[model samples]
Target: MALFHVRMDVHIPHDLDPEVRAQTVAREKAYSQELQRSGKWRELWRIVGQYSNISIFDVESADELHEILQGLPLFPYMDMQVMALTRHPSRID
Candidate 1:
């Protein structure tokens, strides 16, 4: 499996309908939790004072990661940065 670090910043429009925003956020939560339970999403940490979070994912390939990200309910309202991870030779478990 490949490992990745991802940071997501959300920016839902202020003018968006309240009901729609609530529904979308709810869906996002469910979807993210599902991924976490499945072990594809490894870790999640909130960035203090921001509507953003850093996450780790373990997946088969970059393409799979891309697909999982694009499937997020809040995909259209988020800015994301993704980095691939590799173990260092000098590191010991």
Candidate 2:
């Protein structure tokens, strides 16, 4: 499996309907948990002072990661950056 580093910034419009926002957030959390359970999502960290997150994911390929990320309920409201990862040569697992 390949590893990817993903950074996401959420941008919920101020005028979005409250009920819709709540539902979307709920679905997003649920989907995230599903990914976690499947071992595709390795780690997630919320960025301080911002509605942003940095995550590490283990997937077969970039296409697989793209499929997982695009499946998020909040994808429409997120600005995301994805980087493929490789282990450092000096690091021994």
Candidate 3:
């Protein structure tokens, strides 16, 4: 299967307090579970890049990936960029 690169442009709505950040952390984990139930969001690397978190998308195709993104709880609040990728020689190790 082909993979797509998903970079989320996040601007959190609430203040970045310890409590709120904690909630965000839990929500992020719950989001993974919600996505997992759909059988489309395969587990992949979530990178802590300087700007955004990058996740590799492994869905049917770009269109399907869009649908998957739309279904995500965080999608409504943030911007997204997705790029299709070929196999990389390195990474995922």
Task: Return the top candidate by lDDT.
Answer: 1
Q: How accurate is candidate 3 locally (lDDT)?
A: 0.69
Q: Judged by TM-score, which candidate is best?
A: 1
Count of clashes in candidate 2: 0
The alpha-carbon lDDT assigned to residue 42 of candidate 3 equals 61
Q: Candidate 3's residue-wise lDDT over 11-64, tens digit each?
A: 666655768666765876687677667665665455565446677666777777
Q: What TM-score does each of the candidates earn?
A: 0.98, 0.97, 0.60
Q: Which model is ahead, 1 or 2, in terms of lDDT? A: 1
The TM-score of predicted model 3 comes to 0.60
**43-72: candidate 1 lDDT, tens digit per residue:** 999999999999999999999999999999
Q: Summarize candidate 2's per-residue lDDT along 35-72 as a digit string, tens digits.
A: 99999999999999999999999999999999999999
Winner of 1 and 2 under TM-score = 1
Which ranges of candidate 3 are over 4 A from the true structure?
A: 15-28, 34-51, 88-93
Report how far residue 60 has shifted in candidate 3, in Å. Answer: 1.1
Error of 2 at 90 (Å): 0.7
Q: How close is candidate 1 to the true structure, as a TM-score?
A: 0.98
Where does the lowest 10-residue lDDT sum fall in candidate 1? 84-93
